[model samples]
Target chain A: MKNAVAAPLTGVPTPDLASIFGGFFWVGISGFGSALPFAQRMVVERKRWLSDAEFVDAMALSQFLPGPNVVNLAVTLGGRFQGPLGSLAGVVGLVAAPLVIVLVAAGIVARFADSPHVIGALRGMAAVAGGLLLSASVRIARPLWRKREPWPIAIAIAAFGAAAVFRFSLLECLLVLGPLGLLIARIRRHPTSS
Target chain B: MNSPLIELAVVFSQLGLVAIGGVMSALPDIQRQVVEVHSWMTASEFAGAFALTQAAPGPNVMVVALVGWHVAGLAGALVALTSLIAPPAVLAYIVASLWRRFSGTDWVKDIQSSLNAVSVGLIAAGAALITLSAAQSPALDVVIIATTAAFLGSRIQPLWLLGAGALLGAAGLI
Candidate 1:
């Protein structure tokens, strides 16, 4: 989670609005396919805006809240230094290019949606995407197993069953399990406090 | 009320609030809302949009924008993207300001660890369901999935794998 390169920068000036905007904009442009890995590079290593610890904190904060992890990281870091406008600049800069690109791609796909070749390509890519998702799932789960706790693992299984097997709506799953999970956490933490 | 734009706004905003574990964990529900509940797109069309968004740069959340585009237009895309991101972004900003105060609290740590586990489970379900809808050739897709998983720890860029998938598809080999 921590990077050695994230040692606090001693002489780096506080980034201005333009730099924040431009920095994230560059992240948007170069972040082909995925942005997090590059966002980490830019924020922690290249800019030294956030230390490795701070970047990891930002990531945790991003995941703790909703939305994409990278966008959340940008907004949080921007807000940390520059307040609301910084948040705006960070999000807008990060999203600008990708929004246009996705829109254009969507248009092209619409036009060729029926083409066999287009279908084939999309199908192939979709399968690959599925694989990527699987990898991400396993990666995320590995930590839970390493923690050696039964409750977290049990919660994971229940969640997987509810969504993948029972076909519960996301809202339903969250409503039933979100609080339960939180309560379990609280109980585990305060085993003697309560 | 019946406007696709309005529907897009409502659905995405709701999703934005509950999109724990990032957007990946929300994929199955998103597919459900857009495809099953509203019938905005077929399962394959949803899968197609997911693929396109993955191929494009930026966040995977843009799949919402693409779905909106399919249903309404440019305006729809903007509405979907904004609604989906705006609420969460606002929440993120508020929490970031407060994070320093709560950073080392045991409760915060518990919540974080708990959410991590739940997120993993949801993401796994999403991956399985999406593959079921998107995979055209089951045998080939399984191989693709396994190979991709194996190489995940390697240094190869993901774009290469995506590009390879497209080539295989274009050649009708997958």
Candidate 2:
């Protein structure tokens, strides 16, 4: 296992920093509302740098830690493909494009922050955002539903119920579900092994 | 505005460092801190701002800027925006370096798969939370549900949905 881990470190492709940087840049620019799912498809499904399993693993790790999942993915994927330098290129590329656009937009918004038209526009956009987020949730959940894992399904349901109905904090629900998920996984594995 | 600017930078920097599963997952936490703790905005107000940020083109983190701007002004927007995004960017740089060195192990693969499952759950929970918090009227709730259904049922581009929603909102239908 250790040797296999070391193998990628030594033999991983040394992609041109410029090219990788460009990829990250484009991803940042175009990612917008649905960028995350798109990026996952590009890297995991299209590029095959990491298998679906590996892609999910990286996402899990990224989410477990603090910070944006997309940015963490950039580091994990970039680092896996190249090295430390690759990660830097990836991070810079991912953030720079969006940062510039948002800053500019913020400037414009600052001028009209209180305008009725602007407010209306933002309200419309909010609905759209809600839609976009809903779509993202479906995309992420499809695979799990297909797998038909009862525990995961239950965990998802419980989490949703807790937050939506009971109005529990997300952190509280996560604290409850995270361990339950682990315990369930262990039990499932144990049954087969025994 | 100056104090808010400083506050924006400080608060969102903390948020950026802990915003797992994209900006959406952090919504609950941001609400808890900003609305519940700091009283920066009412919960509904935060939701409205979030809606605007989502409607705009760019990362969802742009909401930080909107909230900051609302609280203070342009300076507040800048501070919030920078703090929300910059720390994560820096962290990505560090993690990226270490990740490359550990890419090939089976354990790595296992970990990634498990995390993906968790993210799915987290994101789902996030959606539910937002829906509950933001949707006030049956009409508004219907719009949200319909939009979600449309996104799930078709391969239609997101921009179209956004455009249509904007049109409806402008027309006072939504």
Candidate 3:
């Protein structure tokens, strides 16, 4: 998947490490609720290091593996462009900004956990977080729903039903779905060829 | 104290490596480990801490720091946060390098596309679980469902909805 184009000459102007780090830092810091969509917009659309196809690929891979999707995406995309060092840079940029903000907020919450006002504020924030998460689900689902694949859609429904209704452990649910997905893919690949 | 702190760091570091579909998907495992196995906190306490983390403005993984802080102290919080982020960051670096080399293959593309749909399902399931846990009262349940509907409707920006929820809470309606 290495792009055929040569790396930009060292002396030529390019997006500096500082600028790239800053961009990811802001994106990470501002990610209060809907960080994934915001990060996608910044990296894929605004920065243009990756095309739509590549962005989708990176996102897909990240989601399938462990860790936060945004962090994984950063590493994947960064490595694609600038090797292991770039991946390190991207991860630092992506996480440090958000981690700092969260630490400060946690301290504030600990200080005021007993206060009525803080309690009320937290309640409200919780509701809003629910909204944010719901919105993200819809945003992610919209594209997938458009694909018109019955099996994937069926698997999605079954997975959701199992988790939401049966309260299956996340690992158990994935264990059931992961192999099923792989089997389906294999079948599709070698259907008549097999 | 040192043992718990180290344990907290190690467990959450392992969690960071396996937290697919964000922190929420890992919630079940976190609850199982911390509340059930380690006896660090009660299930209710973990739920409460999760509420706080959701309210806070950052990734859900930040909840690890809050839980660690509660379990030990500032030092615990630092350990938990580092463990939660650092291991996964390193893992992502290794995986990214390999991905870049092999991503051009047809099978890779096909598998990636199929997994996208599955990811959406996992995320939705996680949200549904959170909604159930957060809605304690019938009125609050209605509000939660309404907010979810509003989110799905695409009627307003999520931040505005947050502002409204906060205002309602301030007014004692929520």
Candidate 4:
């Protein structure tokens, strides 16, 4: 198992940096609101860069790590094939076109900030964005509810309180709650086993 | 005295490190610091910028770059984007390399579950905060927010919802 793990994953083509860049660049262009789905389709189905299981694994690790989840996935998958430079290529491709597009849009919006039409549209967009975020939060929290775990739910509530109700900075809340949550998880994972 | 660009770098890099659950989990803090602490933007302006992020493609973390551009310029955008991406990207690269070796270990599982809880909570808080900040007309925004949330997990594309919202606003319904 160790030897198998150490070797490069067989049967998967090792894409060059340009391919990685182009794949993510297309995802950047085509992904409307969220890029994860497009990225999954491209990497797994089209490019076959990684198998479905590996993609899921990368996603799991990306979630637990930091930054944007898709960005992390890009870096992880990129590094898996071609090391640090691969990671760089992946990210630059993913973000470059989108970055330019957003900045240009923002500049236009800012220029028209005083327009009543713009303001109305922005207000509507903001409301929808807020809804989208809440939906995402619910999706993230759903698994915990399904598992029927008490401690994780409690920790989640506590985190919400620390950040929203108490208005503590994110850093402070994480500092206080991160370890406590970890400890509970460790205890819960093996009440008697191990 | 720190330059604005330097301040943007400092602030976003810190955000990058603590962005354990992704940029969504960091939204509230981003809102507070950019709007309240630095006075770089008003609350509504920040909301507008954040809304634009959703309308754009690519990663949501581009919000950082948008804020930087608003505060400074192209240079500010570059600085903020790099700072936010570099730290976390480096951490992710290191962990991804090590992950396969450690995949079988129970430690990864434990961290995954715990971090999920932390991430969910932060994201919820962010949801509430953003909803509140984005509410220009309490009644109309509430309906819009509720309708949007109701469409969650549906086959309907999110762009359609956003477009609906823009149309509603243009029609003076929202």
Candidate 5:
């Protein structure tokens, strides 16, 4: 009965700014195309700072907000753990290494942009990267599996169609679908007493 | 050739403002602004930078930095990247603070769920867009499908897949 109203989770010790930087800095260097898996493993399994469900909640929150999802997650998670400085630390940790590495690679690659093998490899890499991204989408939307409702699926399809098929401007599409989605979610907001 | 550091910053900042679901959602627009609008780089070069991001560690948005370097050296790279990341990171910080304070509420959860639903669709669209642009041959198409299926079905690491791609391409198989 004490737990019936879903009291906010408490007592997870917040990591200091240094650990925050190190954890996400590791995420920066370790990830390939998408950092969500690595970030999830770091915070959820290794750091034990946030539980699995909390990790998912953070993912959902960051995915919709502006900026890179990884950066947003880092900022949000870092802020939750410490404060604004932690937020800055998280983002700097996630971005600093890749920024240097990518710039250097860009420098070297510019000299070789014309080689056919390099070009072909680049093209092939794009296909696989696309695959990685689509696969990630399949993975990120896992919670819908529990809902067992068709409306969420339908909304997803409509969004995919509008963006991928119709090629409407992204802002235009979001504005149109945003309210409908809220209405659907509102209808299903019955509170469950745990 | 005239695309400069300030231009990179201004364009990326504008992109940052309207990039509702992150930079992948803004890919085509980035292509538009970077390739056609500003003439910063060729379309093929832009595509190549994107591929570089896939191989390099971290988020795919690193392609912007690559594009910046390609055009105007280190300063351009710094400008493009900071403009794209800084604004949104601040916004994320502000929103995250508020969200943490109000997170236990039911309405907040409901709104989050709604946004989540929409994100599912956006992710699908983003994957489709990248796939369409990259997979132009039957062999590449097979690579795309196989990699995607494997990723969805198994826990195979993405680095392994990218390595396979590089090997296939180096051997001229794709």
Candidate 6:
């Protein structure tokens, strides 16, 4: 039942606090658009700390738990190495830049809230954001497409309609759609494949 | 009466606990609290904040900071940021340790696969919302499709795509 692709190829190599914090600090700073892939590159590619499979597994575990995906990855991966302190380092390193930048942006943008150019650029940025999100969706759903299953695909469409068109909040869609999808998967005995 | 700082922390920490399937999924609920429940900002303010944050660098969760700053300046910002991650970080730590230890176990495998499917649906839903919100003009539609195609077809870094998008926006194409 091994996933040949995206499988763990390495074991944990002890990384000290400086490396962990410094690595994640850069991840935060360079973490434009989405942070997950940056974190992935930092951990799995450059750091050689976690293999691809471990990163994916850690992501799935945290994705459903709470908070942001990359932040959860930071905390969880840091915990894997140095327990609570590691998690703390991960959070601080990943957040510090964004916190400061967002604060400054909030302050500055408020003063310029009525500028036509500013509004125009933000509108364009929003459109770009849409592209990023759409790319993320396709990447995540890529595996399900290969499996040739209609049910998970249906679930994806339903979930989309609920959130985007029907205007249901995400949790509302998940609460209603999650359990039913899980049940169907359990019945099929191969949940992810479908 | 409560200090808005305390209220910010309380509300965010509480939401952080229940904000499943990633924080993006929790954005609407957070908006509901800040705009409608807390009366800290108007609806348009909330939407603008969210839109700008999506286009910002770093983690997507920084929107919490923007909302807090809008509501009560720097203290509100700090409190909102802290509370948003504290509870979830603790839970994530425990779950990560458990998963690292028992991931290969049959029951663990089952749980992972089940949740993985749910994640797929949830992310797709989030994408849909982003698309609908971002799309306003035909030019923007072209930008969205081009960005998606470039991402799906090439190995170009997303930062480049975002930069290109920003440049296009600055030029008034989108």
Top TM-score model: 4
Checking candidate 1 for backbone clashes, the offending pairs are none
Model 6, span A81-171: residue lDDT tens? 7767777888899998878887887777778878776666666666666777778788888887887877777776676566556666555
Q: List the residue pairs that clash in candidate 4.
A: none
Task: Grade the docking of candidate 1.
Answer: medium
DockQ list for all candidates: 0.61, 0.40, 0.50, 0.69, 0.55, 0.50
What does candidate 1's lDDT look like per residue over A101-159, in tens digits? Answer: 98987788778877877777877878777777777777778888888888889888888
Q: Which stretches of candidate 1 lie over 4 Å from their true place?
A: A1-10, A32-34, A192-194
Ranking by lDDT: 4, 1, 5, 6, 3, 2
Q: Which stretches of candidate 3 lie over 4 Å from their true place?
A: A1-16, A44-48, A51-54, A77-85, A142-145, A161-168, B31-60
Tens digits of per-residue lDDT, candidate 4, B67-86, equal 99998989989999999999
Report the C-alpha lDDT of model 3 over B70-98, residue by residue, as the tens digit: 78877888788778777776776667656
Cα deviation of A76 in candidate 6 (Å)? 2.5
Docking class of 6: medium
Q: Model 1, range B1-174, lDDT digits (tens) per residue? A: 988898899999999888887888888889889888999998877876887877788888888889888888999999999999999999898887777778868888887777777778888998888877876677556755665666577756667777777777777877
Please list the residue runs of candidate 5 whose C-alpha ends up more than 4 Å from where it truly belongs after superposition: A1-16, A44-60, A80-82, A141-146, A187-194, B1-3, B17-21, B28-44
First chain TM-score, candidate 6: 0.79
Q: List TM-score per model, in order.
A: 0.92, 0.75, 0.81, 0.94, 0.83, 0.81
For model 5, residues B1-174, the per-residue Cα lDDT tens digits are: 245888898888877765766777667567767776788877656766787787889877798888788778888788888888888888877776456566657776766666666667877776776677777899998998999899999988777888788778877899
Query: Clashing residue pairs, candidate 3?
Result: none
Between candidates 2 and 5, which one is better according to TM-score? Answer: 5
Number of the predicted model whose DockQ against the real structure is largest = 4
Docking class of 3: medium
Interface RMS deviation of candidate 4: 1.9
Per-residue alpha-carbon lDDT of model 2 for A1-194, expressed as tens digits?
Answer: 12112122223444566756776676777765756776777665544456677666676656655676676677666665566666677777876666556656656755786776665555665666676677778887787788877777777667656655665665575567666676666666567764
TM-score of chain B of each: 0.92, 0.84, 0.77, 0.91, 0.81, 0.74
Task: For model 2, state the Cα shift of residue A76 in Å.
Answer: 3.2
